[model samples]
Structure formats: C-alpha cells, structure tokens
Target: MSEKYLIGVDGSEQSRVALAWGLARATERGADVELLHVADDSFLSESVAFLSEAQKASEQMLNAEIEYARSLGFTGKITGNAVVGHPIAELEEASRSADLLVLGAHSGSRLAGSFFGTRAVKAAATAHCPVAVIPNNDANPNAAVVVGVDGSEASKKAIAFAAEEASFRGLALVAVYAWMPPLTPGLEYLWSEELVDSQRSAAEEAIAIGVAGLATRYPDLEIRREIVQAPPVAALVQAAEGAELVVVGSRGRGGLSRLLLGSVSHGVLQALPCPVIVTRA
Candidate 1:
C-alpha cells in the first residue's frame, strides 16, 4: 500500500515517462505525487545570470511535467520542488519521507535500458524507500508482474510488494526462485538424479513457505511459482522477457558486505527487460 511516490525529473523523455508511470500508480491508489527536480549546480555556468536562468528552467520543467500529468488524466495531488544540490543525495534524503521513489533509466537503446547508469543506481542503493527504475521503452503496459524470491527477509519484502502490485494491476504474480544443485562436482557419486530431485524439492518448498500468506493477503490475485535450476540472474532475466515489471530484493541471504545490492539483484537490474523495483526494507 504505497500511498505516496516521489519522482525525480530531469527534463528528459525517460524522466517524463517515469512521471507518467508514477502518476498512473498514484491515481490508481488515490495517492499523492511529489516531483523533485535537482538542478545540478555543479553543471551550472559561473555567471550569476546563467545560474538564475538554470534555476528558472528547472522549475519550469517541473511545472510542465505536472501539467502534462494532469493532462493525461492524473487527478492525484501533484507537488513540485526545484532544488540546487546533488541529485543523488537530494533524492535519497527526500525518499525517507516518501513511500516509494521513481526514477528513469538513462536515454539509449532499449537493450541498454537494463542498466540505469550511475545516478539511478546510486539513488536506489542509498534511498530509504523502495525505488522503481522505469525503462524508456515500456510501450506495452499489459504484462505480468514478476518477482524474484528466496527464503530471505529482503526477498519476503519484495514478494509483498510484488503481490500488492499484481493485485492492484489485476495481473498474475510470477514468483521465481532460482537454485543450482551442485552439478559441477564431476564425480558421479555427487551428481545423481535423486540428489538433484531432492534439491529441487527443497527449493520449491522454500518458495511455498516464503510466499505462504500471499493468497490470504491478495485473495483475487493469481500467483504462479517457477523453480529454475540455473543461476539466479540468468533465470530472472529470462523470466522477465515480456514482463511489465520485475521486482527483486536489494540483497539476498548471502549478500556481499561491501555493496548494498547483492550479485543477483545487480545482474537483474543491469539486464531486466522492463521496469525493475528494488526493495529497501
């Protein structure tokens, strides 16, 4: 139940696309929307007149985006803020009060949309709220909501978010849990059919237990479970081929200590087919 979203706007087509998505979600849930435009002062020219012009341009762009959203049938309360600061830090601090933060991927080919470049990734990793990275080429709005789940706290949070999204959109929820049975041990004694079957069964049970209460929470939402015996990143990317959205935990059970995002999540973010949400809780 995200009741508010803060979208970062930079006057780019991708940012406008993200605003559209955020506004649509806000309108659907009767939520409030906040548009934040961080005018990178570092990029501003040294002249005082140029600085004033840049500030005015940023504010006008924010206003224009709000008007554009309104024209597109968004009735939710829309507020705009044009500030002079670093975009990532500004967005991350502002995210503390917002239910979610929406950002746009860098402008480029659709295949490159998988990676949000530096700004999106920095804000997502440090934001206090969940971050939704919208790609530029999300032309088809109708696609299943896919989630990556494991028996971890972060994955459970992702499952809850994905389930709510599926329920709201009236779409099916595809829960994917990827596991790799130790098939690399070249010894025959270590690679048997029974062992692989047991591993698969355990993985399936984990997924079931992980999302046990989803049906009760979303009675009308359809839930589908898939167990992929491959690498987590590869399995998730393949599953998200035609999905409308992909959601995953920012980190997993064995996440690295140095980075905020785990290997699987990092890979999925870099190569998902559509918009991707990385949960912070």
Candidate 2:
C-alpha cells in the first residue's frame, strides 16, 4: 500500500504553506495525501443549523486545500476529510494510520491557544506517527538538517528519522547535544572548568551513543556532531538558524514517561526556526 501523509488544513496562508510542503514531500515519496479540516465546534452552540453551517464551511475549506495541492502538481492520490470537532483531537485521531502528520505553524500568534500553534505541538506530542510542523517561511536551501540527540529512546528514534531525511534530501546531518553544568545555587564558587569539562565529556558520550550506527546505515550522508555548553532548547534554536529542517524527540531522558512533550521539544516548537519534525518511537 502507498504511504499516507495526513495534513491539517485551515484557510489561513500558513496552512497553504504547509500544504505545499506536504505535497512536495508526498510527490517525492509517491505517497497519498490526506487533507483534514476540522471546524472548531467546541465554542459553538449546539444548534443544528450552526453546526451544519460550520461543517459546510469546513468542507469548502478542505476542497480549496485539495485544489491547491493539485495546483502544485501533486499527481498522487489525494483524499479530503472535513469534520466538526476540536481540531487537535480530530487531527490526533486521524494521524493513527498515517505515516506522518503535517501541520502549519501560525506566524501571527503565540503557541499557547492559537490555531495550529500550541495545537500543532499538542497533536505532535500524542500522534501515533511522526509529525512535521511546517513554517510559513521557506527553509535555507544551503543548510543541513539538524537533529537533537540525547541518550534516550526518543532521541534515538529522532536520530534515525533525521538521518533518513538528510540522506533522501542529499543534505548533511547535524546531531546536536547541549549540556549545562549542574551548579548549586549557594556553592557557585565550587563550579570550575573541570566540572564543565566533565559535563561536556558526558554529553559527547551520549551523542556518540545516540548516533552509533548511522554511518553504516547512511554511508553517503555527511554527519556532523555539535556539543554546545548551553540549554537544550536555546542550543537547538541556535543550531537551526540556517537549517533546512529540525528534528527533535517528543520526550527526553530527563522528562518523565508520563510527559507527553518534553520541555525542549515544547520550547523548540514555540520558537520554530525552520520546519520542525517531532518524532516518536
């Protein structure tokens, strides 16, 4: 069966940008595109007429997005679904069978409650498959793909996904591990260069373990390692300045298993430098 890529669609220009990104990827992989538009019925009254009108509007939006995809020369199979429900919930449910879930990053609003903002992160955190959040702006054509690495199952999955992406795109792969020295508040004098070096060494080891066999798997892909003495989110954001894409795990080693999204992932999503893909094992 052909691979399926599900995308969340709104009538916004950001969603159109995401549609273009998704269609280009689908065309490359010969995958079917599934466009989903969910009208936010949570705030609407229970009146049947109101719900009917909302559903009708959603269908129109979905159809327009489908036409947009066709206009972009995506010749593969395309499917559209318009539903009246919470956008995040519907997208999460629809992503179960998809190979990837794509969403638009809202440029005008903060990521808390904005459409396709926090909602995109929320869907990415819980989606069964990987989720790609495409920004409205274009990526740097000459930059490599960056992936966050740590000695965690989630980061391992991210490394694999990022390596595959870089190989397919014929771009370099940058695996980054950011570490900060553990300093006690009252014992600031105890912090020294030796302790910092120890932390750096540990970070290096973790990153090495995270990308153990990628060289054999992707012989042609150029892989680079980045060990930064900073916070994970800040380091990743900096590394993504000129990156084509950024890949990060949903959760990290320090994050609790019950945490759907790690602090780093959430922070990266909030300040997305480029199109970010949150991967899951």
Best by TM-score: 2
**What's each prediction's TM-score?**
0.87, 0.94
Error of 2 at 79 (Å): 0.5
Q: Report lDDT per candidate.
A: 0.80, 0.86
Q: Write the per-residue lDDT of candidate 2 for residues 106-149, one digit (tens) a residue.
A: 64325536667778877887787899988777668758999998
Off by over 4 Å in 1: 43-53, 106-116, 183-189, 252-259
Task: List model 1 lDDT by residue over 135-252, tens digit each.
Answer: 7774447788999988988889999999999898999999999998655555757767888899899998999997898899889989999999899988998888878889988752
Model 2 TM-score on a 0 to 1 scale: 0.94
Best by lDDT: 2
Candidate 1: give the clashing pairs. none
Q: What does each candidate score in C-alpha RMSD? A: 3.3, 2.3
Superposition TM-score, candidate 1 onto the true structure: 0.87
